[model samples]
Target: IYKHSGELVAKHAFRVASGLDSMVLGETQILGQLKSAVRTAELAGTLGPKLRQLFDASFSVAKFVRTETDVGAHSVSLAAASVKVGERIFGSLSNVNVLFVGAGEMNRICAEYFVSYGIQNISCSNRTLSRAKDLAETLSGDYFPLSDVAHKLEKFDIVLSCTGSPIPVLGKRAIEKAIEARRHKPILLIDLAVPRDIELEASELEDVFLYTVDDLGEIVNDGMRNREGAAREAEKIIVERLVQFKSQLDRKKRIPVIKKFRKRGELIVQIELEKALSSIAKGERPEEVVKVLSRAISNKFMDEPSRALNNDSTGEKLSLSEALERLYGLNKN
Candidate 1:
């Protein structure tokens, strides 16, 4: 593990929270994950006050970056890319019938992306019709059984398939026949599964435009490249916010020392004032009493600090003496 002290620690966390260090560069989901981890630690009684402040500062920096710059603009996720490719082929998706195969997480996300893009007609199919129906209801669409996909394929203008099946759920012949039934009106097929829910051979058929996960990844990468400028802008914002946060952190660290120093000075003032009053009551000259009081107060305040300086090792003493001089603005004088 790497160790960073003072401001560097906050710099690292702020950059990561803002997605500057992410693989997709400006990807923003990681910030949410960090917040979730923070909540877990809070629930377990592990996060201290200082650590909580650091995370809170990082979150503030992330939100500021999002507002001031386009760091999270042009999202490069696969779900968004699927919609991009659909628009490329069909001009617009408002009139298209979308078939979402496999009501799994990936398919559900893609279905949501399509619906959010204003695609009115969509259907869901799964091995278990209940899951598909649930997803369909969530999207306000219709549901069909996986077994019926082959015969019903022609009804959809776009087919998005992602499943955990070890074998292909869609074959070349199935797509080919669907094209014939559609009178070759052109169909867009997006396969986002690892084992490939749609057969690779389906790409060879006419009027069947197929895109795999790798293809969408390339589109996402193109988006990542386009966001480089925004990422740099966010980096600049981090540097500015880091400096401001560091100053605030330093002041917070000094608060206890400031309180103790003020308390000790007050005690010295009270003790010396009593001594001065006694001398005046004993018939000492006013000048003599005032002179003695001032000298006593100064010596008493300096006594502990003088001893501390004398007790330190040579190097520590020199550094501490210089710091004290600067703190008192003695060097400036």
Candidate 2:
């Protein structure tokens, strides 16, 4: 429902790709996510010419944002944030039994963060049991099928989920049952899925603290004061790049107009040359024929402008006259 000029729309995309407008200031995850989105659109054949150009330029801007600035110095990621939440809630993670759902890149990253804290109990649950086994083996933890997650939910103190499921895997009632079975022990659940692996209503349950992708970013941004200067510097780079891209876009927009104008001039030249050739063939003087050709071409060029000035019904005709005078130097005499 929103309408914006191409330049303004591109400006927003450029800022977002640079992580300047991210919920988590200078977070690196969004760039990967944007790349994935573009790839998906490409596969689906929905990536139009302008959109493809926008994303391609955006990726370049993101690269400059990272290399040209110190914004990447403070890498407070959602995985780290999830670990922070566990530490805050449990006071100690060495004994906290962790359950990771969907062994994707996000889960692997979060598992590594938890491992860094010296937590030993980590389990992986995924639809592909083999994938779960691979991640669990890497993390030196146990593995289970995702189908068993709901039944075994009460066994873990913390659960981190990121899946490509079309529907919510953990419903509100299931969470309530798990909380009841755990005897009111609090559970920290983080869902980093696009369609949400956990139910939205599950967040309302007691003894359950649920944080989504956006929630993690908002929480992480609160502690990102160190990156503010780097963010400003990155913005300067984006502005410079945007101006260059805008100039390119402006030139592209003028192509059709320039082509049409040239076409009209060529047509006028062709008509006059044909008449001049016919007059010469009928034994007219070559110099007189050339003179007629030049005058006819001049008049043809001026015909539209002369009619526009004479009609002058619009109040803005003065501006049109000014433009004509400026373009042709009609006042030179």
Candidate 3:
């Protein structure tokens, strides 16, 4: 599905989850992720006009929710749950030395949340040291080569791993050595990777706490229910925004008509100006000639738009006029 209509479907999914088409509205993380996903798809050349429109509307709805409702004002996102889990294991994140494996998007987000919790001694290790360094700069942390994980594992009180490796990066024996080096000081490990970064056996060892992405699901579900009422209000805001977006999109379809009108008006102006210039060159008074040319051009320009406005039987012209009025800030009192 992802290969064929993945981009479009993902974009629509974001719209729905963001409350643009949701039962509950203004869920911030989903919308932001949706936008990110859309951008990624666009850059990959997988996004088409249909998907783009849906994603754009979704973004509009998400923005409306942020501005018009309290849905995102007090929301708890998955990132927050990850931080909570870290806090639960360590008690206070203030003094914990943290190392993040992988400089991917999820790792960056988790690092930001950890920094928010007052973790200062943070570092990142990735296969590409440059990528790790780039992410480290954002969090004001240090970077190390991925191979150094074994040597430096004991230094950090917490390890958050999420990389694109097929095999486990941290095995049971390696963690066991790190735990022994720390003299049994507890190490909290949060693995956000899909195929799993830390070996499952590491969780069974004493003084090493491991929480995978699945473990955080419960916390997120609990947090989601707490804001159910706010979500409904957000959904209402999204629906209104979606309707407004559709109206704007429909108005955009009339661009060719507006373009044709402008083109014809310019052509008429050019022909009349040429005539007026020819009359002046043939000994007509310069001031009088200029005045006549100005009036002629003005009349010619206004003629089509005025005619369309007056001879409007169907409401298409009225709708177009209203759209233009709103666009140009022209008020008819």
Candidate 4:
């Protein structure tokens, strides 16, 4: 009832498009992260049945996208786009030394992408030297102190930054000094952070090519068009899955009614059993007492319904019987 329906719908759409699950089946970071978020909400008691249903539907839709369509085949990711942009600018990423400004997930992904492109001269710098060193060691890149960026910025031809700080991590003046030190060599800088790690003024420099997250939008849009047809097919699968989930939810709504009916039946049995025990205390034989109690209780329960059916002349009892059968899972067919 909290209306998580819209969020669930969007989550389903995103998981299919983001290559979190592709036809080729690569790494599944996005899907795992989404599931973890849902699980956290559930643990916090913030998730209701509606949201739970929606998330379950989203996961099912993601599965359908992976199995039923080729949308994920040759998928283009943000990190891959960074590497592609690097290749486009320098013509060969192998000769370009790469530097990452943060030890976050995005930075790690970009570093991995660069390394995969044979770019061995890589360096990582962070506010915390230990974190930077850890990421550098895993990627086999050199680690630099955050303060060393001023001295070392000129060393790398491709600079990718995504720090969490609100302020710009790389200023125009800092890049200006780095550019002069490199003797006007072309440098491609990618800023994937939201608040923007690289200053916009740096783009005005002659030899520096700076790209923000917004700049990657055009590239991502172009790649998305190629997969539009498959996306449409995946949408159809998602709708079908949602319908099935909703139908199951509707059926679950009948559970309370069934429970109430069973509770009433138990009460009737308990009352009759008490009466039988009282008769046993008055010297009734145990075997005959049990047999008589069973028949008497059965007759007492069914007598009213038998009399009503006999008195009804318009087949109303048949309708009631059908309704009860449907409710209690006693339908003949």
Candidate 5:
């Protein structure tokens, strides 16, 4: 419910979407979260032009930072770190089988990253069949019900679980059985849920490497420290963006003044041209008509500024020529 105005909101949104404020510095998942939140606000009728503009600028800033800086080039998120750990163990993921235990946002992101690592066989199991199927279809993987996880566990060499169950989804016994079924082949288990998805005792099992959210903290912190330079560069970009956006807004505010001035000038030109044309039609000299039209337009254009300069009611020391020079950025040299 925090409210901000002017550049404050813009700055905050830019930092957040660029991942400067995230635990994993430059993790791209926050950008999607921000976009989703913006879309939700739009559907709820709470998004306005200013907010939309700020978010649009934020998206651009995030993309620019990622492209220009190495902010997102390193493994930052727990999900990505998990994939890295898996790659370190298996040397490559193309031949390994991966199982994602939930179809939530975090799992979705993790699945996408794993697929990018060339994982050919990926499966998803969730409490809801439809959600699991949707995520599986998106990743070109198989979907199964949560109840089938135990039976299918042995087939996966890597298991990433982030379900919201209050109790542990896979205990030591379940993992032990899976290990026995695999003939003691090694398995990499990553539990990313807050309350813990895999049982704590599962870490003690042979041929199993179990890692939890706490285990990923060191990696996340290291990533943050490594990206400090890139983060500074991103901050500079945000500052420049703020100044640019403000300049654009200022120009937008002056548009009406410009339009009004142009309209008035057009009207004056129309009146002067008609007068000159009538004078010529009435047999006046063409040269005289041309001279009168030029002088009349120039006089009309200067009249308001001349009067204002003469009045000098604002107590400023600017002379007529100086005022005109300042207004138009004219140089005497």
Candidate 6:
């Protein structure tokens, strides 16, 4: 129902899928999101040949940008930013005890970043114990139920929560108790959830360093500015890709025309060949049959153009003869 022109829509979709329009510039998540959308459209049979071509070209462009540019050379993902913030607070992530409060995609990505620093003391707690256990095992960490999160909170120095909880999962009172149990040691609490897994009041606690999704946007913006040069290079690549996509679409559109033309020519050849063979079978002269075949073929090929030229009723300045002469590059002499 959106009424953008095809060129504009293609450009916008390509930019978004390529991460040029992302909050975290050059982040890989948007590519996956775009792929998922395309797959869904394909499954629903709504992705026709043209759309398939466009999206395929888009994927190629995204891959080209990622491989050819340094756009994603920093911590652009919010999950990755959490690890950076943790390192900033503790100097090194390897020595810190990290507790991921969810086993979803974001938490998994965050855990991977932390584990890359060789952080051995990692834990995951989720409503579904199996999913949490799977995530913990992948990171070589421990898993606990959501109910045990409050009691176990004091054990970890850095806690990152990304969940779909409607209400705040960790309240100020709960975090304050954890800080007390930890002898007032500072805890980095990253709330990646939309509704906020950690209560807003927890930010007021002196020992609880709380950061929400909005806070992460500042880091993501800094990354975007840093990659501006790479983004410019990516835009150049997109221009090239756009040219290629349009050329391909034009060529595809001409396929039926090309086929029809070729079929008509082949049919004319068959008719001429049949007439020449019939004359030979009737004992007509071989040289005469050859002359008749060539003449018949030429006439058949030019019949439509001759008829169109003769039927020109309008007294245009550029007559049909002049048009045909120009079209065929005929010498006036």
Best by TM-score: 5
Estimate, for each residue in 145-243, the C-alpha lDDT of model 1 and write its tens digit. Answer: 999999999999999999899999999999999999999999999999999999999998888999999999898887877778888888889999998
Which regions of candidate 5 are displaced past 4 Å? 41-47, 88-95, 99-155, 159-218, 314-323, 328-330
lDDT value, candidate 5, whole model: 0.89
List ranges where model 4 is wrong by over 4 Å: 1-75, 229-333
lDDT of 3 by residue, 1-333 (tens): 233353445435534556544443344446656678888999999999977877676666666656765555442655777767767777887888999999999899878977876789999999999999999999999999999998889999889899999999999999999999999999988888989999999999999999888887777666666566666776566556656666776788888889997898788888988988899889999899889988998887767767887788768887868867996688956
Per-residue lDDT of 26 in model 2? 82
**Pairs of residues at least 3 apart in sequence or in different chains that clash in candidate 2:** none
lDDT of each residue in 168-252, candidate 2, tens digit only: 8899988899999999999999999998999988888888999899999876675476688788888889889999989888898
10 residues in a row with least lDDT, candidate 3: 1-10
Tens digits of per-residue lDDT, candidate 5, 161-278, equal 9999999999899899999999999999999998999999998999999988888878877776778878989899989988988887789889999999999999999999999999
* Cand. 1 TM to true fold: 0.64
Q: For model 2, what is the alpha-carbon lDDT of residue 142?
A: 98
In angstroms, the error of model 1 at 317 is: 5.6
What lDDT, from 0 to 1, does candidate 6 have? 0.87
Which predicted model would earn the best lDDT? Answer: 1
- What are the per-residue Cα lDDT tens digits for candidate 4 across 1-333? 224353465554455434534542333556777789998999999999877876677777777676777665433567767877877788877777888999999898778877776889889999999999999998888998888987889998988899998999899999999999999999999999989888999999989999988888677665566466676776677667666776777788978988986887787788889988998999898898899889977887777766877687667988766665785687565
Over the stretch 1-333, how does candidate 6's per-residue lDDT look in tens digits? 456687877787678778898876787778998899999999999999888887888898898888998787666668777877887788866678989998899899888977876888999999999999999999989999999999989999999999889998899999999999999999999999988899999989987899898898798777667688789998988888888888888898999988998999999999999999999999999999999999999999899888887677766435877877896889656
* Root-mean-square deviation of candidate 1: 6.3
After superposition, the stretches of candidate 3 with alpha carbons farther than 4 Å from their true spots are 1-75, 229-333
What is the TM-score of candidate 3?
0.49
Lowest-lDDT window of 10 residues in candidate 2? 218-227
TM-score of 6: 0.61
